[model samples]
Target: MSEEQLNFDFFAELSEPVPEPAPVKENVDGADEISVEPAALSEAAAKAESSPETERGVTPFVLRQAVLGYLAGQQPTAVGIRVPTRVKKFQVSMAACWIAPQSKQNHIEKVVAIDIFDRREHCLPDCAEREELLATLKTLKLEKLKLEKVIRENEPELKDSDDLFEEFQSYDYSASRNTAYHKLLKQISRLQHVIYKGSRMELIRQAAVADYLYLAVPAGELAPEELADGWGLLHVFPDRQVKVVKVASRQQCNEEGRRHLALNIAATSLKSVLFANGVAVDEHLRVSFQPPPRRRRKRL
Candidate 1:
């Protein structure tokens, strides 16, 4: 071939890219080949797509678990592992009981209770409101009787007067009483809520009086003043590290109350609360507290 022709052939070969292999097609009686595009996802991509990411949080449940683990990992009488505990009070939810000196199993050395924020409204009226309501009812009763007397004396037969008399005679204070009762209940609920939110120290004080060493977390602002007397604060960190802000040692604990907590903890399984964070406890504890494997419901 001439030099120019040889150069032309080389340039053509370089300019035309090498063709890639087409997807293999079925060879059936010279049938028309149908194209099928390959998936873009690689092996890793497929695996990743198959499983979605799980949600994470440092919620109170999580913090409590961390505290449980931290405490459980301790040595004797040294804030050791959390024993099964229960809430004796209807209002309090989280609680724990630890035996003292690691010797006596029956005696409860410490009772730790966490007071979380409760937004549930109360339903009851204040004393002043109740007194005012009573006075108002008394006034309405007198006015109703006086109006009835005037109507009876006048013997008015007008439609409006008749309605007024009938209403007075058939006046069912039950409805009014019911309305007032509900309002009072709402007031009470509000009072309870306010007592819990603004002045939760009252509840904490009650616990202290009961001789329970109470510990609250995220350390509320008022906790310093209200709970400062006897209550302790637990400061939990993101890295699952629990720092005890204020250590409260109960000098005199309600033995019965502490026992009730222990019994309640003993009654409920750990999986319900502690393992709620997706972390499992030790094998022995798991066996003891772990819920029976939830039977998977068959899909219809």
Candidate 2:
């Protein structure tokens, strides 16, 4: 083919350039940003979408199983473990060290879940350690028996025994009038620990009958409605002097709330409070009570 004929063919081929398709538009407002496509969800995603798995719905049996399974892989003295699944969204669920009062089992495992489910809300478990409904009622009845025993022991003061109520205001009066009995209840409460079920939130307060107590709490999300007297529960319990209470209440608080309430009860009742921060007990668990340093008088 002649050079002129080849040049003409090349020019003819170059004349029909391919046209590029227009870029896809995401927002109708003429923004260059494209729409974010949702990721394809897996089975885990499907379960999450179907229903919220929080501490509330989690059973003690399931929690015990999970803790045992988890601990089997770790040290027996391990304090806590983070659960990746079976927790409410935007929450951290943990199983921590606890002791059962009924059995005096050391390092008893308990579950705790926390998030800001309700900003204004606070929760407290009634008592700790797993006791049957009848057992607890019977225990309360025993409190009555103890009170009667105290009255009988001090026979001369039976008429004024009712006045003992005035002196035991600081005690947890859920059962009896004796200061010793209230102290026993506090001990029982201290031994009691909280468990985070599958969907519930837990809270702890600085005071049992706090009008507006400082709280360390956990839940799914802290919403504004949960606040009680301008107190929003937050999760920042220290890892020492901590106890859990499995209190029997009309309603159950989530694990986090129960933890906070238990810690507060421990702090006020026992002169010290510790939190289970997923760390095993060590030298750090010991909290010493030191007197304030005396100031030296200025030399005249």
Candidate 3:
């Protein structure tokens, strides 16, 4: 009650420091301890929302590229070119990256995410072409199957005693029929090319040099110098051909960088095939690059 005591107590209260808040534990592991470091929770949430699942066959990297490109009003082309490695270039599901039309629903199936390289756009050979090709193949396949069946049915008799074997051989129609059918099927198979317009990019064959440039070949046949990173190149050793292809980026390459690279490529070929649907870059293909035009000085 003393005036001195009241004055001292009031001053003590004024000088007392505020108690600190309890530390927050983010996880059971001490390593995950929460810090007071300032960060926007909404920013972290946005990142989580943006994170993509690569396991479900969706290339998160590619999808991101496509989304960004779309937002910028630039269309990115999909490349199905293959690489020899099994490395996961993008966080995506194998099915999404490998299968198409079926995995179209996958978010990664967009411009950058989709494999447009090995895509066979195959026009199903125009109705006329389809009808012609299918008819020949069906006919040849049917005859081959029939001949094979006939040979199997008469196998016992054909394998009879040695003396009868000679007589059986004399009357053998199976061998001749089989030969005919084989030849026919082979001919039909060649016609199968007529059935393939090539993948969608192929349909854009007109785009070759005109709009874009693409080559469909077994990854193996491709020269080492021609190979690009990130792509899984499947080569058939015997034929020296590339059987399957997909687009890939190098470890250091990011989606935006790749988009620029692709755009540059498209621009380079734009002058050549700008008017045609197809352009062939065969062994005889020759290209000579001219220096870019110089900028003139501005008048003062």
Candidate 4:
């Protein structure tokens, strides 16, 4: 079969709809919201058409499997998927370690973070914006405290607990304070979301306890400009082929970091094995194995 035909056959097996560019819409104020330009949208569509992975159904799971195979080929001493890093919130999609040739105790570790590139804006704030948002959140919290004080001062003194409850329900001050509290809460929640998304890169940097870091995505989905410096890029194809686009720069990993990475991989692998064996973990995190019931022999 021709290479082109083979490639087509591979993509035909998978079924996933390619994401379309979001249409521009006017806000409630009648102002046009910023969105992808017509030319950029058309260019993205053309690129997606040429790439079988994007055209077909190349999900994150499929891309992860391809990267796993590629990692296996490197013949690392140990490898794991969905491995937790030092930071609890962030996880390395794939992690591997190689034993140093000269030193049995030494290991060279590597980690990869995988993400699908969607054209939609994440609405993550820049450093200056994040600081401003944090300051606003702090101010709002202080204001909420002051409002709470006002509610307390306005509270009607009732000798009996029953009368206190009845009086509190009809208090105008309480009602007004409740409204202000909810408004402040909504603003705080929105700002928190923006801060979390904006801090993703920072979290990843803290989590990575490896000699090298890599970012993997579907071929043509990620742009070079989006990738962080010192990190490598791996392009996963629809045919389950992984191509290295950029070499990861080596980073310093102390003995502590290496040990931490190794322990995380081991713990994750142990959990996977226990689950595979049908070991049950209760809410308290106690593991127990239940043996299968033996079948009785039939008499002739």
Candidate number achieving the greatest TM-score relative to the actual structure: 4
lDDT of 2 at 17: 16
Evaluate model 2: give its lDDT: 0.30
Q: In terms of lDDT, which candidate is strongest?
A: 4
Candidate 2 local Cα displacement, residue 89, angstroms: 10
For residues 1-300, write the lDDT of model 4, one tens digit per residue: 134421222111111212332332211121112121212222332332234433445655676677777777766677776666775445666777766654655544443333322221221224334444445544554555565555555654412234344322323333453676566556545544444443544455556477677666767755332444445666677777776655565566676787788777777787667666778788899878875445689999
- Over 4 Å off in model 4, which ranges? 1-56, 101-198, 285-300
Badly placed stretches (over 4 Å) of model 3 are 1-128, 155-177, 197-300
- Please write out the lDDT profile of model 3 over residues 1-300, one tens digit for every residue: 223321221101111112232332122122212122222223332332355443323333443343223223322233222211112222111111111344545222222222212211111222233343444444444454465445546554543243333322222333443565456445544443333334222222212212112232222333211222122222222222122232232233333433443444334444445324343444566644444555689999
TM-score of 1: 0.36
Clashes of each: 19, 49, 37, 0
Taking all chains together, the TM-score of candidate 4 against the true structure is: 0.49
Overall local distance difference test of candidate 1: 0.38
Candidate 2's C-alpha runs over 4 A off are 1-92, 98-172, 175-199, 202-300
Candidate 1: where is the Cα deviation over 4 Å?
Answer: 1-57, 75-91, 100-105, 116-201, 204-212, 219-223, 226-228, 249-251, 270-300
lDDT of 1 by residue, 60-109 (tens): 55555655654454422323123223222233334555565555544666
**lDDT per model vs. reference:** 0.38, 0.30, 0.30, 0.51
Alpha carbon deviation, residue 29, candidate 4 (Å): 33
